[model samples]
Target: MASMFRAASVAFFCILSIAVADAQPIKPSASTQGFHSRARLIGGGQQGEHWLAGIEITLDQGFKTYWRTPGDSGLPPRFDWSGSENVASTEIRWPAPKRHEDAAGVAYVYGKQAVIPVLVKPKDPTKPIRLVLALEYGVCKDICIPANADLTLDLSGADSERKAIEAALAKVPLLQKLGAQADLSILSIAPVAGDKPAFTVTIQAPPGTKPALFPEGPENWFFSASHPAEGDRFTVTIEEKPKDVSGPVPLHLTLVAGDKAVETEVSLDENGKPR
Candidate 1:
């Protein structure tokens, strides 16, 4: 009877130790320095089948980094996870970007500090995940400079940074259907005859909301940065396009009003009528 009790006590203590180890916070990797910028990896332990992670970037004052789709000028960030172990796939969730204009052109970017959340899926849920990242990105002030970073982390369990990662995730634009009746919505898009293709986009937003629009299209398609017009209207002009292009153009429009943003897709013909 005494032997049985001792065995049970040992098993309980081992299980408790494992639990505590899993709950301990995972430390972030050291920062990889770049020109006027630095980058590193921070993570929130496993949520379910995937781990919540973030790429934290700090930029020098007056410097900025480009979004996944950099407007007319800078290059978008490229993340390579091929060196990772026990990883199945990873998705980088981008928060809505602010539009910046300069003598070069209009560009969408993140200023000062940016935390980009990533969802990492592992091949084996029960085992630890070794995350390796080779990040290639660009930063700009008066001129643009290419930057690179190599970072790695071992995610054995949960980390204290989960809440911060969640906060960044919240800033990612909620995908919405075009013309949805929401607090901030795209009401209409009409074609404007111009030297090049152009459209007048009208949005319905609250009185206190200061709205901005960013349009994205396929390769070889470029649009003039949108600016506020009379009332809730904004005009988007086509700056460049393929010579063989014809018919309706499919565009992904990101509407940002204050701290909230929504992305929607619309197909517009030469008449600006939605098809």
Candidate 2:
């Protein structure tokens, strides 16, 4: 009877050991070297029903990278995950970006380091996932250099990089409805009549905070950064309006102030009124 009890105890200990091993943090994949930069894939364990991951780019001092909407004269990062397995869908989240004005033009960029958070939904959550990413982006100092990287990782356990991923996630702008009433929100949008059609935006922000606006419109449409016209009022002019496209234009606007940020979408007609 004592021998039987010992055998059962040993079996229970083995199962516990396996569970602990599975929960251990996974190491980041090998980095792909680039000019004054390096890129790699990092697992961030699981968050609720979906798995979290990050594409970490470490840049040398004085080097920077572009955001999803590279304001004026930069290349945005492009990601391809056709080589991945067990991924049903993947969503890349962009953190609030900073505005930089140089000879090239006003651009939105990240300096020093950038970690882009990715939320991946697995086709089968019970099975292990193999994440493979093909990334193409640009790093700029004085001149811009295009870079590419191929990174892969088998994600079945937690990762030590989870904390870093969460930090990036915190910077991602929260989604809010257009004209939402909040301490930091877009109060109103109106049409500005000029040589070129423009929109005037009024935002509500905390006192002593300087706010900036980033606007994204339909394909082939480019807009200038919101220029402050007066107190709490800014104007965004249409730079390049797509040819042969008429009717209402949809705008995705991101507003950032100090440590608060939010994103909202609205559509306007030729008259600049909400459509």
Candidate 3:
């Protein structure tokens, strides 16, 4: 009996060691130590000026993180590069996020790991970019805690890591072209005129399959979560629009229908035709 008990204890130690190795923290300036994350510089375009980048995050077992729009709950990951030099603009291109559920509600998150593709535009293309990033994101299982990282990657030597960036870039979602007829394409986004002014987005998807629609926009506007109507169309009711708005409103939509998904950012004229 004593020998059997010792065997079990050894097995437990081995399992714990494996989990710890898998969830090792990323080497960074400051972090909560729950997960590991860092910024990576991909190579420049082939004979072009633009460069690619990514944020690689690895979470421990049973832990999760949020997307830009964490439906109903959770804090979205935030990145700030104001301290960096020779950088004019930076855009984060998110891959399709996974949906997670808890007692509080649903959350769109990255389970276990995620790589967020980034587009970096520099003030001078000829010179190297000294990119710096300060990232803050939530890590949750039952209780959520904030995790922070300070990462710096010199772009001069990014050529060595070309393949890694290429792999992540492949996951970035491409924009849906106008007048696409494929079943995965979002056919139309029309205004629903009634008691509550809403935008009815119709996706050309499979019948009876409920599609998941995620809306991305400024912080002030609220685009209520949508559901699949009868047939191939889905309706996204606009709960609120910006007040005293004058410029054109561009709505970005990501539609997930089964294994197939697509995204588009387009502006609609008052008449609802694609603009």
Instruction: Give the 10-residue window scoring lowest on summed lDDT in candidate 1.
Output: 266-275
lDDT of each: 0.85, 0.87, 0.68
Which has the better TM-score: candidate 2, or candidate 3?
2
Over 1-275, each residue of candidate 3 has an lDDT whose tens digit, in order, gives 99999999999999999999989965543222434433233443422455676676778788888888876678788999886678888888777776566697667788776777667788988787766787888888887778877776666644654566666556555689645888777777676665655666777776655577787655566655545665555565555656655445677888776655678887744333335
Clashing pairs in 3: 26-36
Which candidate order results from sorting by TM-score in descending order? 2, 1, 3
Model with the higher lDDT, candidate 1 or 2: 2
TM-score of the candidate numbered 1? 0.84
Report the poorest 10 consecutive residues by lDDT, candidate 2.
25-34
In candidate 1, residue 175 scores what lDDT? 88
TM-score of each: 0.84, 0.86, 0.69
- Write down the lDDT that model 2 would get: 0.87
Residue 269's lDDT in candidate 2: 75
Per-residue C-alpha lDDT of model 2 across residues 252-274, encoded as one tens digit per residue: 88998988899988896754445
lDDT of 3 at 230: 59
Task: Tell me, by lDDT, which candidate is best.
Answer: 2
Q: Which stretches of candidate 2 lie over 4 Å from their true place?
A: 1-29, 270-274
